[model samples]
Target: MRRVKLSDQIAEDLRRWIVRENLGPKDRLPNERALQDHYGCSRGTMREALKALEVEGLLIMHSGPNGGPEVQQTSAEIASRQLRQFLHFQKLDFKHVYELRRSMEVALALNVVDRLTAEHLTALEDNIRLCENANNEQERELARQAEVEFHDILAEASDNPILVFICQFLNGLIRDLVDYRAGSLQEHEAFGARNVAYHKEILAAFKARDRDAVAKAMDEHMCCAETSMQQLDAAFYSDLLSRR
Candidate 1:
C-alpha cells in the first residue's frame, strides 16, 4: 500500500477544521507557528502542509509581518483541473464523455428550464449570435466555444450544486476534445452551423419554459454533437497514424 505524505494528512486535517469551524473565504488560518504547535508538527512540515493546501486552492498564502494562510473561494475551474489530473492515466475518451452527457444533459435541461432568468436567456441568445456573426477563422473558433458555453449558462440555473459542478467538468473535457480535434474550416463551419441551429431551438424552448421541448431539443443536440465530435476524433487519429 502507498503511504500518504504527512503534508497531505495535515492539509486534510486543516480542510476539516475549516469546515467544522464554519470558516469561509477570506478566513485566515492561524499563523504557521500556531498551527505547528497545535498539530505537534515541526515548522518545516507545517510549511509544507500549508503550501500543499495553497496548491489545491484550499488556502491563499500571504507574506511579510501580516503573512499567513487564508481561505480562498474555490471554483469549478480548480475542480475540473484536479479531475483532469486524476483521470489522465485512465482511458477516458470522448465517447465515454458523451455517454455521460447523453444520460444527464436532457434531464438537466428539463430541470432548469423553469429556473432560467432573463439574463440567462439573453446570454443564450448572445451565444448563438456569436456563431452567426463570426467573419473569420479565429472568431469562428470563439463562436464554437460559445456553443458549449450555452449549456454552461443553463447549468448555472440549476439549484443543485453537485449537478452544476459535474456538468461544468464534463463541458471542460468537451472543450479540450474540441481543441484536440483535427478538422478543416469546412468541417468546422458545418459543425458551427448545426450548433447555431440547436442553440436557437434550445433557447426558444427555454424562453417558453417548455420542459418537454427543452428536453427533446437538448437530447437531439447532444446526440448530433456526439456524432460530430466522434468524426473529429477519427480524423485526429487518422492524421496521427498517417504521419507515423
Candidate 2:
C-alpha cells in the first residue's frame, strides 16, 4: 500500500477521536497549537488537516475568544448542495440526470408500494393540498418543497435509509436546475397540475399495494419530467440565447 501523508494520517486520527469520544455538534476541538505539538507536525500540516475536516462538514473553524474548530454533524441538505455544485461544474445534461433518476426512483417505488402506511398516505395528501392552495410564486416554491417532502415520505416508508438519502439528494439537484421561480405563473400552474396528477396516480397505486403499477407510474412520471425539462430548455434557447 502507498504510504499516506502525515497530514492525512493526523486528520484520520482526529476523526477517530471525535467518534470514540462521541463528540456532539459544536463540541470545540483542541487548539491548533495543541494539535501541532501532539501530532509532531508543523503548524501548516496541522492546518491542512483541519481544513480537510472542515470541508467534509465535520468541523467548523471559528475565530475570536469564543471560537475554535467545532465538530458538526453533516446534514442531508449540505450534502445535496455540495453535490449539486459538483454536478453543475461537470455540466451534466438533462438526459443523464433523467436516466439516473428513472432507475433509482422506479426501484424505490417498487420497494415502497407495499410498505406505505395510512400515516404516510395522510402526509402525502397534506402535501397535495398545499400544492393546490399555492397561489403566488412564493407559495408555489413552498408547494415544490412539499412535493419533494411527499416523495421523501415514500422513500422513508420503504424502510431503506440508503434509498431515502439518494432520493433526497437527487430531488434537491432537480429543483435547483429547474429554476421553478423564473417561469411565469401560468407555467408554474401547468407544471404543478401535472405533478399533482402524476402523484395522485402513484398514490393510488400505493394504496392498492400494486408493485407493478407503482413501477409504471414512477417511470411515466420521470419521463414526463424529462420531456418538460427538454421543452423548457428548447424555449430558453430560442427565446433567451438566440436573442443574444
Candidate 3:
C-alpha cells in the first residue's frame, strides 16, 4: 500500500472545509502562519499543501505581506485536463474510451433530447455544415473538433452536472486520439462523412422528439465511431512498429 503524505491529507481536509463552508471565488484562507499553526505542520509542509490546491485551481496563492491563498471557481475544463494528463500515462486505448461512451453518451443524449433550445439546435446544425465544408487538412482538423462540439452542445444542455462533466472529459479524450493519430486525409474524409451522416440522423430525432430513435441512432453512431477509431489506432501502432 502507498503511504499518504501529511501535506496531501491536509490539502484534502482543506478542500472539504471549503465545501462545508460554502466558500466561493475570492474567498481568502487564513494567513500562511495561521494555516501553519492550525494544521500544526512545518512551514514547508504547509506550503506544499497550499501549492497543491493552487495547482488544482481551487485556490489562487498570493505572495507578500498582504498575500494569502484565495478561493477560485472550480472549472470542468481543469478537472478534465487533469484527468487527461493522468490517463496519458496509462495503457488506455481507443476501445477503452468507447466502452464508456457507448453507454454513457447514450444516456447523455437521452437526457438532453428534450432540453435543447433553439440556439442549441442552430449550433448543432451549423456544426454539421462546418464538417461538410471542411476542405484542407487544417480545416478538416477543425471539423473533427467541431464534431466533438456537437456532443458538447448536448452535454451543456443536460441538467445532470456529473453527466455533463464526464461527457465533456470524454470528448476531450476523443479529440486527442482522433487528432493526433496517424491517418490519411482519405480515411478522415470517410470518417468525417460517416459522422456527419450520424449527426444528421440524431438531429432529426431530436427535432422530432423521438426518444427511441435517439437511443438507437446514438448507439449505432458510437459503434461506428469506435470502428473508425480502431482503424486509426491500428495505423498509429503500425507506424510506430515500422520505426523500430
Candidate 4:
C-alpha cells in the first residue's frame, strides 16, 4: 500500500483551515514559524505544503518585511489554462473542439435570448462594429479578438457561471490556435462580411427575444464559420494540433 506524505497531509490541513476560517483572497496566511507550530510540522514540511498550495494557485507566497503567503482567489483564466493543458495532451483538433462548442453555444444562445438587457445588447453591437470597421491588418486582428469577445459576452448573458467559463475557455483555445497559424490562414475579405451578417442575425433574434431563432442562428453561424475555416485550409484543424 502507498503512504501519504507528511507534507501532503499538512497541505490538506492548511486547506481545511482556510475553509474553516473562510479566508478570502486578500487574507494572509500565518507566517512560516506560526504555520509550522500550528501544524506541529517541521519548517521543511511547512514550506513543502505551502509550495504545493501555491502550485495549485490556491495561495501566493511573498517575501520582505510585509509579505507572506496570501490566499489567491481562483480565477477562470487559471481554470481555463488547466483545461487547455488537458486538451493539449489529448491532441484535440479544431474540429473536435468546435463540435462541442456548437452544441454548448447553441444552447447558451437560447438561454440568453430572454435574459439579455440593453447593456448586453449594446456590448454585442459594439463588438460587431469593431469587427466591421477594421481598416488594416492590425485592425482586423483586433476585430477577430472582438469576435471572440462576442461569444464570451453572449455566454455571460446566459447567467450560468460554469457555462460562461467553459465557453470563454473554448474561445481562448481557438484564439491561441489561430495565433499559432497566423500568417497561413488570413481570412478573405468576404469572410468578414459573412461573419458580420451572422452576428447581426443572432443579435436580431435576441432583440426579438425569439429563443428558437436565436438557437438556429447561432447554430448556423457556428457551422458557417467552421466550414469557412476548413475551406480556407483543408488541414487547418490538424495543422493547429500538430503545431502545438
Native-structure RMSD, model 1: 1.9
Q: What are the per-residue Cα lDDT tens digits for candidate 1 across 97-138? A: 999987688877987878999898888887778778872466
lDDT leaderboard ranking: 3, 1, 4, 2
- Tens digits of per-residue lDDT for model 2 on 1-244? 9999888999999999999999989788888887888888999999999999898888999888767789999777778788788888885656767778888899888888777788989998887777778735667667666666777777778777788888878887767766632352246667777888888999888888888888888899888877876666566556666668
The pairs that clash in candidate 1 are none
Better of 1 and 4 by lDDT: 1
Where is model 4 more than 4 Å wrong at Cα? 1-9, 62-68, 135-139, 231-233, 236-244
> What's model 3's TM-score?
0.93
Better of 1 and 4 by TM-score: 1
Per-model TM values vs. the true structure: 0.92, 0.77, 0.93, 0.82
In model 2, which range of ten residues has the least summed lDDT?
A: 177-186
**Which candidate number maximizes lDDT?**
3
Model 1 worst lDDT window (10 residues): 177-186
Cα deviation of 33, candidate 3, in Å:
1.7
The per-prediction tally of clashing pairs is: 0, 0, 0, 0
lDDT tens digits by residue: candidate 3, 1-244: 9999999999999999999999999889898899999989999999999999999999999999989999999887999998998998997779999999899889999999889999999999998898889834657787788888889999989999999988999999998787677362357777888999999999999999999999999999999999988887887888889989
- Model 1 TM-score, 2 decimals: 0.92
